[model samples]
Target: MEDRKLTVRAVERALDILLCFTRGSELGLTEIASQIGLHKSTVHRLLTTLEEKGFLIRNPSTEKYRLGIRIWELSTHLPVFDESATLLLPAMERLRDRLGETVSLYLRDGFERVRIQAVQSEQAIRRVAQIGARLPLSVGASSKVLAAYAPPEVLRELLESAGWPDYVERSAYRQQLEDIIRIGYATSFEEREPGAAAVAVPVTGRSGNVVAALSLSGPVSRLSRETLVEYAAVLRETAEEMGLMLP
Candidate 1:
């Protein structure tokens, strides 16, 4: 069978409009239209359709559009971000207690890694990666772990979206990520944020696909490279055990 030559111009335009409203900037129809180079009427029609479907909503007072709760509901069904987090939380909790360091379950969300669940360590000096915190995928132990295990296509897509940032040299970052995959885990100190250090290992599903990452983090002094390397074995063991228990 041959593929059909289908046109998705309108659909692509609608998605582009939705992408414009990110991180608290609710956009008006004209703004969205201008950004996407679509006529106001076309954008309005697309927005109205999306609003009726509960993917977008209009503010009566400001007349601006923002993403609706339904999108959040749908996001919860993503197996990697939601189910993997739920499945790994118990193991993460136990690992946190055993290691006496912050433990987090993370999954790739677009160009960032999202901390779906984090157990803060009860130590005099500890690192804190808040739940829902988004970190760039090209930096840090958790992010590197996720990127190292991700499919080639997915990693390519994320890098393109992230653009070329100079925070870290691109070639060195790529080499680091390659080393992470070779070692089956990753460790970083003060890469994404100052005063933080962490190590992370990939968590695979029963089908042997990387679904999430498990990490232990703390202050650089406490979670030194040697300490992180020591805990890396524990993280890998715990993640493997959890993978076997998932449905």
Candidate 2:
């Protein structure tokens, strides 16, 4: 538990096991051991400890492990979430009300995008972005904005890895990222979910580097191209104000 260089072996291995799920939502004992290069016995023991601490859960039927609610609880405590969520709630609510759609704030975490704050539409049927939800950084408008603005090496690594859809050409994908930056926003239509559409703008920190994405989401039936274009302008302006509040 020391802040110094000496990392406790058991703790390190436990953290590594938790990280294994970042690639996939669930993993069996053998799969985890193979990925982390550890023995089944060691993995099982660590998994047991993690489960007891409420950090992981095992499905009784499938026997696969997945991250537990404790992870979600911890995510709420992250400094970025703690600070930004409260600071931006008013803006998100206003944006949501004005746009008549769901507005969400997404933060990039590893190869995933986390929804730290959200204001849902008043309509009976609307897109709901769950707080603490972790989604692939390869899809959706917010995901594109977040990944596109990540550090160069990080973006390059992502571009060469599992982020892009198999059918999308790499060269064109790179240009799209450039366009998102040059145009100051991004858009996705049913990329992550069927019938869903979204527009995103970058939220920068004090460093003038993108720290998160502000996205408005709705059903395709409502968010037509013209509507999205108008939404982009509002979102871009709101994102700029939100960025000023970020450290």
Candidate 3:
């Protein structure tokens, strides 16, 4: 019982130290100790342990701690779908068949979006998206659809961190995000990659919160402006169907 209590307390302290860096990019030992109400020596020991374990890293120049790449590596292994993709795979396949384009399902992972599933187009001249690929939330139709419906706090964080295109004014981009939420879909024309176009719609969970994005993508030569709008309707319908079935 004593061992278990000690282990739990250590874990709690470690988590507290980690959480202290969330509001900012990096933090010093004294700042973490002050924020978590721990002694400076205790915080130093915990930070050293965490840094050795690859959960945190100390910048040589700043001499402050920040989250390490191990966090992202571990997060990529997390099960984003939880059997929800299995339920939606057939619908995605059907949508791909109907549109004759690549269909993909994307889920938000922290500030990024990951492609969890894909139904690739059979055509030789098609745009392909590999499964398990991570993309920035600021670009692409799938990412935009997920971002558009994200909670206010999450949306604000993404916008603040996102290096948006110079042509896209911050106020105008914010308005576009609002429009995407209002219209129930998003579109991208060679935005993330050249010669590619995509349209996407948000998949809601039982709580009515957006959980994923259903997207159709193809070569820009094939998926023109008119075609993207037409397929957007199909994507929205399929997303609604999946939303009803998600737990």
Candidate 4:
């Protein structure tokens, strides 16, 4: 007989329910159950357990559920999710201090890149990335670097799923990936959102695989082609340093 699984899938489902609340919303039980495809009773059990742990709170009058304070305390040790940012913040700070530009850390999640950490420059003009913001895979410097350096299977799946929409369909997205590989970084402007220009470089683990992307972002006015080229080199060096420290 196969070895018994260590953890119950119900517990996993419950955790997923808690994480979904990270969007900062109040959701009713039906909505939560529907999202995760669990029976009402199952979701209720999960919610009750989570509530006991202070991970979820149910409104008495509204019957809505929202994340609880215990999650904040529990999440302090989420190294896998926060490691890219936590490990790189000091370097990002230094980059901002030296270059007077904003810096952010991104990691690939399925077909998207998520900005986990960002620090703004002290300059009168600055760029900011809202933490937990998600960006599509087909656009922007960070996404390109992620695509280029990601595992081959991940790259293939991401490109296949992205569907090459007209927004990025005009550009040779494949060729762009090739260039990102050859050049060791990527630069793009207004591809995902207008007026934003960015440069991104890969952060490699000890095994020499890219695990994350470190990027500099600002308005196109300040981050011209020449400026981006210069920033790319800085980003690559910094990211390489940060990657070595990863567990």
Cα TM-score per model: 0.66, 0.72, 0.67, 0.70
| Candidate 4 to truth, TM | 0.70
- Over 116-169, each residue of candidate 2 has an lDDT whose tens digit, in order, gives 888989988899777767887777889889878898998888878855679667
The number of clashing residue pairs in model 3 is: 0
Ranking by TM-score: 2, 4, 3, 1
Candidate 2 Cα RMSD after full superposition onto the native fold (Å):
5.2
Where does candidate 2 stray beyond 4 Å?
Answer: 1-77, 162-164
Worst 10 residues of 3 by lDDT: 161-170
Point out where model 4 deviates above 4 Å.
1-71, 81-84, 162-164
lDDT of 1 by residue, 1-247 (tens): 1232223666777778776765345888878888888889988889998999899989999999988988889877676553656666777889989999999888788778888888889998877666666777878888888888778897778666647476777668778889988888899888876998889998888888887888888888888788888888999899899778654
Clashing pairs in 1: none
- Each prediction's number of clashing residue pairs: 0, 0, 0, 0
- Candidate whose lDDT is highest: 2
> What would the per-residue lDDT of candidate 4 be over residues 134-235, giving only the tens digit for each residue?
777888889988888778897777666736566565348889999888889899887766887889988888887787888888888899989999888888
C-alpha local distance difference test of each model: 0.81, 0.87, 0.85, 0.81
- Shift of residue 87 alpha carbon in model 3, Å: 2.1
Task: For model 2, state the Cα shift of residue 150 in Å.
Answer: 2.1
